[model samples]
Target: MAQDAKTLDLIAIGRSSVDLYGQQVGGRLEDMSSFAKYLGGSPTNTAAGGARLGLKTGLLTRVGADHMGRFIREQLEREGVNVAGVLSDPDRLTALVILGIRDRVNFPLIFYRENCADMALQPSDVDETWFAQAGAVLINGTHLSQPNVYETSLKAARAVKAAGGRVAFDIDYRPVLWGLTGKDAGENRFVENQDVTAKLQEVVALCDLIVGTEEEIHILGGTTDTIAALRAIRKGAPDALLVCKRGPDGCVAFPDAIPDTLDEGVSARGFKVEVFNVLGAGDAFMAGFLRGWLRNETVETCCEWGNACGAIVVSRHGCTPAMPTWVELEAFLSERERPFRLREDVELEHIHWASTRDRVYDELTVLAVDHRSQFLDLIAETGGDPERIPHFKTLALRAVRQVAGRDEARFGMLLDGRFGLDALAQAADHDYWIARPIELPKSRPLEFESSADVATELTEWPAGQVVKCLCFYHPDDEIALRERQERQLLRLFDACRKTRHELLLELILPAGMDSDSRTVARAIRRLYSLGIRPDWWKLEPLQDAVAWRETEMAINENDPLCRGVVLLGLSAPEAELLASFEVVAPFPIVKGFAVGRTIFYDVARDWLAGRIDDEAAVAALASKFKVLVDAWRRLRGAAEKAA
Candidate 1:
């Protein structure tokens, strides 16, 4: 079998095309939502995964010289797939598939390819030399269903096998692409007439490796038990690797040797995870196996790595979006005990803004002090779940797990009252965030001139890291009644410039002045004119009367910069104002917004001016989360250092 010129890890020969994916709205499959495009094809996705895992991978397909074809080529190239054998057909258009993600279990793909160039691949496209070169060759059964390319693939596979290069076959069974035979009343009908599922079983015998999903196994299983399937496969090609992908449960691998019993063969479980889109998780797992195979790892190890790769791939929204980077993958494998964390953390707290909840808290713990009616309202109104607690860690844990969990693999975090380089370094390992309240100086609230200096200090903190800023608009300021507070606005801008560095701005406005006050309108126009781009601008234009129409009119009154409005600042009666928004602005306007100076300016500022101890601040956290005039001396110490 040692006849090849040189050894190569893997070579894949198959039909490649761009699959334009769309999502299903509600429960309707045909009634689709807006569509999105990606460079997707069965073998192409597998090759892309292999290349991403640092494997030397290649694709052999005949694609037309068209936009979709070019897109596929670029996508593969970006993934670093060797495209030396990928040929171009000038006459035909590249193949395209309209893919629908109905649910995690169902994907209905509509192929728009008729006599696509990829299926036109002939035996003469290349000598058996290319097949003879690789350590393993992957042949998608799609091309093999076509006569010319089908015969060519079989022959090249034989040659590669004879040359000691292993053959791996992906029975990428597509019904629409197969059933059609010809245009003028030929013995056509791709999927209808042919027993391709059986034909693929024949190739599986010859294949050194056979990879497919459980559905595929069921299609070709032929009423056979797992033992009987192996026996049947062994009848044709006795010594080859047989694998089945089982999504989150990982995959099963049985190398060339099939024992007399199913229990005797290799059987291993997979990594567990919650899934999102899951369309290409199989291909990614294949790439994982191929990479491990290339490294000459043990068969068990190869299967384990495949399981790991598939687990990560399926947990996210898209095929490519959550692909584990190389360094991260290594770290994931290396860091055994630590749980998986998201790239960033968001903080939420049991803030003492709820008057009613405070009463409930007196009788019950924070966790048990449930708003039974509001939770019911949350579910009934917006379809959000109610049983769960409303904290950043709770929400984040549920989101990452894609389910309510007691599982340890998924994680969520809350602040432990820490900061700076060491905390940040430690935070890099944390997956979720806690609403860590940062206070201003009690002696003086933050001013614009001092903002830049604060920003300069943040420059040394971290790069591309997010810091939440907080501030408020004064209700007693002259801007509400007479005219715009020019000096105040200017100071706000200066603070904005400074805090944009290390701080995140939480623009708090008065519950009363949240309306289309001409003063507020003029101020907004001024900010627009001066080109002052704030991270967020809270729109709190509420009217005295609690009508949806009043709230609608207030929100609709055309401000110069419509998109600039970040949060819809509102209070209790203004709560119905959320319903008034015809189109909920890009951001959400939540209730129970409590500020420091606005609420606990006296005690907190006293604490910040070194009037209280850490014990007292801890006590404050129990009572409420308030916007005092400044933060405790704890943060002020850092501020002075930064100064």
Candidate 2:
């Protein structure tokens, strides 16, 4: 029960569910055609939101032993939340909620939680030692509606309190969840019920902090008057900090006496923005408030953090995914003239997109075998069946596996869906960093391979696969040609943003364009000016250190959150590629190489011509790939040593 013994900042206990949000805004749920899935439930969102804000948080709940449960656990882990206590219950199914945004004020939702796994949470599921390590614990009011979950949450709260940790309560009052309304009325936030009021009051009495909106406070205080509700709650838990979330007007906090007016308490004004969905705003506010409160910040600062977080989430779509990261939160707060529409803020959106990505590759040594036309041409030259190209692509993947040995973080494959479908599936199964091509091979002015509807096409690709579009571009191209290419690129960039897929824009100078060191950098700047900020850039290796610096500076100045760059091999010989590596050794922006023809051209040709067996081809390809990797490492090491 020592302060030093507590390691985690917070542990959230209560509901966890998979939310299927109707994609069509301003449409009724019955007429909705498509849905986007996101993690949901009050405590789960709080845990993830807290973790995203740099808190060491944990979740204590039960999920069904199914794919959805695995998704919840994996997502929590991705958010940097400790899931040691997220147990899988084989007896029940995980909870689910189908939600739709009809408009700003009308959000229709249905919760299918009739004997769900989270409600099956038992006292036995609460681990005392694990609960004791947290500095604070948060339990939502929904968990108290059921006896089993109520006992489970109470036991965990007692464990944390016994360890000198604080307990916070979020009065997440849902009348449907408490069975006070029809099963279909999940959108109903409150229903006056004496039993619900008494139950919430019991939980509120055990808290160091209590947070709720006016309706929620009404349910807890058994009164509709805001000041009377505070007086009621203060009488029960006199020392607890009471935070009242007043939607657009921001939030207010009371540390001691119950004030006659809500404005008498410590208050912070919310941002002026259009509300998209008010589903997860309170959970975000709770996470933000904890970020400051756990750090012992002033009450005003806590209110500000909470208000900003709520404001940002209300203007976004889903709950858990809409939670802002610490960097995003700071950026939003640092703005002097805040945008009226937070969703339209380009820099904030970029920060959210970059920071919330599930994976980050510090360095990528990828095998660029995403060539379609080149493979067909090679097959034609060898008089071999084009059918063998897919198998050959599979062999290339095997070669990468042999060299990388499942080290997915450091190694990747740039494969095309046309010939490398099977290989792409296998690579994705092993969680490799994969990129697939969209642009037709060697198309001047760039045309998509399959369909002009790139957004629809991207939906078929796996979420992990980056949309790799190789554009034959030159900054000095004729105005018409340049504009056409830029339009296609802009379309592709917009598609990637919609599909939530990372894009790697590979820029190559068309066959006979005169170029200097500044050409590529200028091309990058032109794209940035057009607002085409791809997550990754694939460029030909620069000729000198000055060129590399220019490229780095261009990217850094335009978008620091750009995922850096990967060097592309344009069928260059191995010696030439190695020399280019030496030139790029000192620059940290060039992550690694995605060389194809140099490593695989000869081996692939020999294999296609039946001059070499599969094993021989794989061995040769792996050896060549390892040689380039080693050369990059050696040169990089030497540069480090010299510095």
**Candidate 2, clashing residue pairs?**
none
For model 2, the local distance difference test gives: 0.91
Q: Model 2 — which ten-residue stretch has the worst lDDT?
A: 335-344
Error of 1 at 144 (Å): 1.8
lDDT of 1 by residue, 427-518 (tens): 45433221222324221233332334544444343332333333344434454431233443444445433333212233444446554434
- Candidate 1 lDDT at 615 equals 56
Best candidate per lDDT, number?
A: 2
Give per-residue CA lDDT, model 2, range 1-643, as digits (tens): 7766678999999899999999999989999999888999999999999999999999998999999999999899999999998999999999999999999899999998999999999999999999889999999899999999999989999999999999999999999988899987889988999999999888777899999999999999999999998999999998999999899999999999987899899987678788899999999999999999998899999999999999999999899999999999999999567678888898899899999987777678998898888888888899998998889888898988998886767899999989999898778667678999999877897999998799999988878789999998989999999999999999999999888999999998887889887888999999999999998999997667787999999999999888889999989888999999999988888888888988888888899999999899989999999999888888888987998
**Cα RMSD to the true fold for all candidates:** 22.3, 1.3
List the candidate 2 regions with Cα displacement exceeding 4 Å: 1-5
lDDT of 2 at 168: 94
- Cα miss at 153, model 2 (Å)? 0.7
